[model samples]
Target chain A: MRIPLKIGDAFVYGFAVVLVIISFAGMYLMGAKSDRRHVVIEMDKREIYSIEIHEGMEPVELRVDAGDGRYNEVVVMNGEVRIEEANCPDQLCVKSGAIRSSGQTIVCLPHKLVVRITGAGGEPSDVDDIAH
Target chain B: MKRYIAKACPMALAICLLFLPILQGCAINEVREHSKNLFALNTWINIRIYAGREGPKIIDSAVRRIEEIERRMSVTIKDSDVSRINDNAGIQPVKVHEDTFKVIEKALEYAKLSKGAFDITVYPIVQLWGITTEHPRVPTDEEIREKLKFVDYQKVILNEDEGTVYLQEKGMGIDLGAIAKGYAADEVVRVLREEGVQHALINMGGNVIVVGNKPNGQPWRIGIQDPRSDGVQQHIAVVEAVNESVVSSGDYERYIKDVYQKTGVRYHHIFDPATGYPANQGLMATTVVAENSADADALSTIVFVMGAEKGLGLVEQIGNAEALAVTVDKKIYTTKGFDRRLTVTNEEYEIVP
Candidate 1:
């Protein structure tokens, strides 16, 4: 029995294989994008800023004006975030130090400000929240 | 035959391409999370609901419920039920909302159970110390002693039939700082469950109450904050919880940092009603896990003030509740049932038998 061998059939098979590969690569990239960590800054429950954090990214400094002459200086570098300075009374946010892990937060009570790091892929520890 | 093969192969690829988006949509449907953040009761509150399109509306209702509770219970709110009761101390019984009455009634019960270890009438002492204020200081011994006179829970008179509260002494005040957040969390959980929400996480300033398992059918992992660590996410252990509340009372929450750095004495916020001073019990932090957030919230403070041995004893006596107490010496004492639920992640601390 002779198998049907035609150039047109080979072209069809090649196109099918290429289509499958492209779809898989698209799915893989989408998955990888969700894993990227982002720093979210919220003031009075409103998100004011957000930036994706990745390895070897350029350091960024943000001066958040919380009105009434109050301000918080946020520094994001090397995949970690910290409040470099703040005019708030407590200075607790500055003292919280650098937070790199997902679900971690630095809060300023006086300013009603919150800085949190979150990853869509979920944290390695899988912690939903910290009981303090 | 060759033409048929080519046509069939392209048709199959076209069919696969058409189904790709539907499969992705199914995967997205498995995890539907809607979260909202707000400030209430002098703390940050985060509510996440994993339900259908009604999640956002449910969260809005939950926030309104919290605000209502705060208005009735907050000491700082001028027209609040608590404020009215405090202002009328020794004058007459002030009618309060049922929520306020219920919370005070529950608080008094905890006070009686812990033998005054957790007293809501410690408000005068809390004001004197002002640890949560801008200028937290080490109050003089004389000042603490003066406020101690008004630090008795028995002075809070509750008329359940009238839904009223009165303080026997004019100087006495009631502050629900220790347990109000828990009540708020439980209220949120109740609302979520009633609205057909199967999975949710309600965090009222670290008083975490999880409703059911995660969307993926896994238990929620709640990190128990390490008392000695300054980082917000640092946890000595993680507890797997399902339809339960986890609350911790720790010296690390608020303190007089200047005094601590100078005198090596941490003037923290969790006060001992008996002494009108910060609880100097051997334990640095105490975590309570229970079916209700309010009970867990009050229990964490009771255990922290009572120390390790006595605290764990009270938890064991309660039967339904479990506690994890971390000593100043880095020793963790947990209830019998807690052993199976907790996984120690930090090696700096050791679990004691």
Candidate 2:
């Protein structure tokens, strides 16, 4: 196939070059963290850890920091996982979709609970997040 | 890698010599450093030569070949090869450039590998929603569900010898957005080999395909974005990719930002062909590393829309392709060897089943 040497092609190509130079040369805006795809947190009442996932299927286990109060309800739906019913009023964490990707999350603020997705591949968590 | 290049060079050299003056030295060509192919949608593209001599004119010829392909494959051009072929998807066997036909053939192969989980026919649904266009608006459920009737990849028909493509349905359209970049990355590899480019890094936005290693013999360092953190994250992770391709599709990349305060950003690009709107799946992003680079690009989008479980299932079933998913919960999950390639931080994230 022959490349058409029309004026528009030149103009457009020229524009792209200029744009590339400007963008690369210009101050680079802040970028997202490139490593560590997940994070887990342990609080007073229970232990919370969020899991980050990619395009696939695998069983991920979360050892709920069952302190004095127990983990009453647990549920998994779609690609997310969350507590279906809890003692907290907000129930905000449960209301959110099953914690699926690094972007989607569940937080039990009152329980000081935080479970999130983090880096590399999805490895399991059998230990406590905090010393307390 | 050396073994593969050694056996392939002799044939490439013979074909390259026929255009001798146009392709001298095969490796360090002066003209190749600059001569722009005015037609290949002017973008800042870098090519690495793999097989031929680096003669000045050969790089220009190789780049020009890419420009020619850009013309042949662009969907916006009415007279281009893709348009004519796509226009006749149902009525006739639309003849096309070998490159275009090759992409279709590969997409078909990937479709089979993914069990139709990744489809090219999603274009109709994409256009109907007008996600990337200025007229972006949420389409009704009925509208989306109705159009999804033709969103099957199996409907794509191909004749390899004749280089023809046909869409079984009249309204069914093909969107190369998912895989075109990867194919372009492959084309860069193709041209580099044709022009004898031994080492190169072709980064089309996030779709990356590297050759050999860096000039210093170090593996390329590719940083996957930290979704929680702002801007480009500080952490740089090393990846082992010589000739292979790395492609990532994430929710943070493209979104329909609100016109006013820029709140309520709608992620419209990763739509569920089944649902006809943005995929309601919980996944926020998906990235795939694979042999062809382009497959990684297209498959990543398909897998993202498929959600983690189904998407992971599809990846495992397809084989050769490994994925890393960051669910909304901030956990990172990946296929078998994917764990080995990643560097875990003290920061913790949940790993969903």
Candidate 2 versus truth, CA RMSD in Å, comes to 22.0
lDDT of 1 by residue, B185-207 (tens): 99999999899899999888889
Docking verdict class for candidate 2: incorrect
Report how far residue A39 has shifted in candidate 1, in Å.
2.3
Flag regions of model 2 displaced more than 4 Å. Answer: A1-132, B1-59, B227-238, B259-265, B344-353
**DockQ leader:** 1
For every model in order, the TM-score on chain A comes to 0.73, 0.41
Q: Taking the tens digit of each residue's C-alpha lDDT, what string does model 1 give over A44-127?
A: 989999989866789999999999899999999988899999998778799888877766778888899999887753235458
Each candidate's root-mean-square deviation in Å?
5.2, 22.0
> In model 2 chain B, which range of ten residues has the least summed lDDT?
B30-39
Question: Could you tell me the C-alpha RMSD of candidate 1 in Å?
Answer: 5.2
The TM-score that candidate 2 achieves is 0.60
Report the CA-based lDDT of candidate 2 relative to the real structure.
0.59
